[model samples]
Target: MIACPRTLFWIVLLVAACFLAGTTSGAASVPAPADGPGLTVVMDNNYPPFSFRDANGELVGISVDLWRLWEQQTGENVQITGLEWDDAIRRMEAGEFDVIDTVFYSEERGEIYDFTAPYTDVDAVIFFDADLPGISGLDSLDGFVVGANRGDSTVKELQEKGITVRKYPSYEAVVSAAKAGEIVVFILDKPGGVYYLHREGIQDRFHYSAPVIRGQLHRAVKKGDAALVTKIDEGFASIPKAAYDDLDRKWYGTPVAEPADLRLITFFAIVAVLIILLLVVLNHTLKQSVAMKTEELKQELDHRRRADEALNRATQKLGFLNAITFNDLQNAVFSLSGFLELEKSLPADEKTLAYRQKQAEILHQITAMLRFAKNYEDLGMKPPVWQNVSQTFLIAISHLDMAGLRRTITLDNLEIYADPLLERVFLTLAKNVLLHGKTATEISLSCKRTQEGLVLVFEDNGAGIPLAMKEKIFERRFEGKKGLGLFLAREILSITGITLTESGTEGQGARFVMLVPEGAYRFTDNS
Candidate 1:
């Protein structure tokens, strides 16, 4: 159905050339003709191998041969004329020709042309690009733009089924319209469509489905031309059944085999197989390499295991030795303090009293230093655990005897993973504020979450630390009321990677802000 003009033109030339071989029956067997009526019969040229032209511009096909036989049997000069399907129909409607030898039967056209008794059957089918999946039949044509030859049986058939079709003037026009995106599929008689595709050298470009509409193909004459219709029926009846069989065998005996390029398929198949073999070899090599590396890694881990045990044993011994030695030194200091106390009570002048006082002061400072060392030694000795911040703050404050200090605790369900000495960190902060904030009152504890971490603010409204001394406040043995509380608090927090900084209004209150890193903190849903 998609045959180009040149294709049919060439076919017409070939058929005409067949006539030039001296006579139409020059090569083939046929009964000699006895001329009768010289009537002209017009038909659609688009119906290839049925009623189409050849390379010599001569008519040749199923109906053409039948008409030739009809002329031989009936002794009539049955001249055949070929026109585009649509033009043929228009001319026939205008009575430009006396009769149409090959036309499909439909009720709408019955009003315009009288038809003979039905002959052989023809199928209506769907054709589309071969790359697409085959659609089973008409029921599957929803949403498709179907092309149909104008005035062809396929157009009215598709329309009756409520399917949309773009009518083209000719087969070539339909193909062009489809290629131009006007339609997605085309509808036509299956064999003629396939033969057209073959002639055009585009058989592999398309595929067609089984019959969608099966109808009895009939030849029609002018409306009320009962005489012409009767004559066609007589011609068909006169033809022998064996002659019809012979014609069928001659036209459609051989099946058209699909011309495929097998060499390309074989080349790609070999490449695929080689790539698979290479992957197999590489996989085996990689497995062997991994096994060797794994053995080496096992040996390295064995050496590290022995080294770690030795280091742990040595650390344990050092800790035990330090504990024993510090205990003995503390006893000796206690004994010296007692002896100095007894001697100071016995007797002395002003200079002697001052000398005794100096000795007592030095002993007290030494005791403080020894106690700090003992507490510091255990700071990071224990693994960190999740401790409730509110409970820890309460415990730290309880030990401080904050009866004279008014402070509010706003800690909710917050908890953090930190050393057991975390309690001491808070205790140290409370003790520092009591000793340092001279006019301080109303200390408050609250928290806020930030991009970098969590912040716990311990602040008080007081004549806070001076600007120059803010950073210096946390320095070891700097001029606080006495011991290194702030410095030791920072050291305790650092064991678990928490950081502490002072960021209050210096004149209003001294604020200690502790930033707990991201992974180290989470909130309880109940809070």
Candidate 2:
């Protein structure tokens, strides 16, 4: 509740001198029974709805009406005086009034006044211009200039949070500054602020957050005035609950419905019906569109299925023909070998013998080329798979003579996405090491991770490749070699975007690095 006593005080003087009129002539005036004890009440006159001067130049509000009823219940002469909040507090402490209504209790005030039980709760909130972003409470007012009444408790609250605030004399002045575009952020009691905003037709220009501080409104008497406290509480308690509800309704409830309200209600009902109808039509149209699209997709899937079956049939036929051709060619080469062997036994001149030897060498190269082609025929025939690197390397070395060779594999349980012929790649590298790695004793396979990818390495303690031939070695034309092993290894790896490169010291060893791009490799275990 925004009703902090000392901090909320604000001066709004009435020039008409109508301050004492309510005590003598308004509904608050009560005939004094002879010798009856009396109580004088004071509160902020400028606080709207709770206490304020009406346009008729007379002080009237919930507080005023409440005290009038209190007089009837207690049979005591009650004097209700309205002044600026600060002035009311000053005069009450000066002993000019017996009670001050609409006050918030605080520790400092506890030493000066004895407060009655709280009668109502009010909320204090942060009100900001609608255009101001992120202004929810005191904490959010850091960069913006905030406005508050000169003595408002909210001002101190803002200041404590390290926010700067511009002080005004009263809430009225604060609202005026907002309307003038002088201040875009301010704090005020919600009810009074809302009432003023509506009256001025500026409610749309500002937005308010939920209560930043909730305070209970109470009436207070001089310290040590226990008798007066009891009288005030008892008088209020004696009033019927319905009476309090009526006052709340009069001040805060929905306005009384008029004849024009029925027409407004009718217009809103028609708009709501139209909106519902529009939604129903839109829903029906969307369902029809979805159904049409679903049918089109089903037809597309069926067409692809038929095309895939045809492709598979053609591939199987081609594979069978290729197998037959390869078997016939191998048989022809074997027969030629027998003929050459017989010819060797028949002595010939040196020149003729040299030509025969040359022919045999060409036959051997041709055989090696045919074997390579057979092996590569299935490359990329199937989708790439996640092969366990360590296991695959072991399988590759199994086909080689390893009587004296030692192998070290630190690839862990790493898996890489590559052509099924991935194992063939490792086999080719191992074979190269055995054939070309002069003086090599050990071969090792390992992997290291880099930003671009995982580098799968194969190295052997051998006469390593020369710097000039590192890349050229992967080319099929290298050394005019008939075996396409290295060249095909690169093709197999490239199927899944992996690259093979050699990066070994010339005299130290041979190192083959296969870079498995990111997303193509991962470890299966904690190695």
Best by TM-score: 2
Residue pairs in candidate 2 whose N, alpha carbon or C atoms collide under 3 angstroms: 1-122, 1-123, 1-214, 1-215, 7-151, 7-152
Worst 10 residues of 2 by lDDT: 7-16
lDDT of each: 0.69, 0.73
Which tens-of-lDDT digit does each residue in 313-418 have in candidate 2?
4366447647865785677677667667766777787755775776676577566656766776787566566778876775566446543566666876799877
Q: Give TM per candidate.
A: 0.42, 0.45
Model 2: per-residue Cα lDDT at residue 359: 67
Off by over 4 Å in 2: 1-37, 253-527
lDDT of 1: 0.69
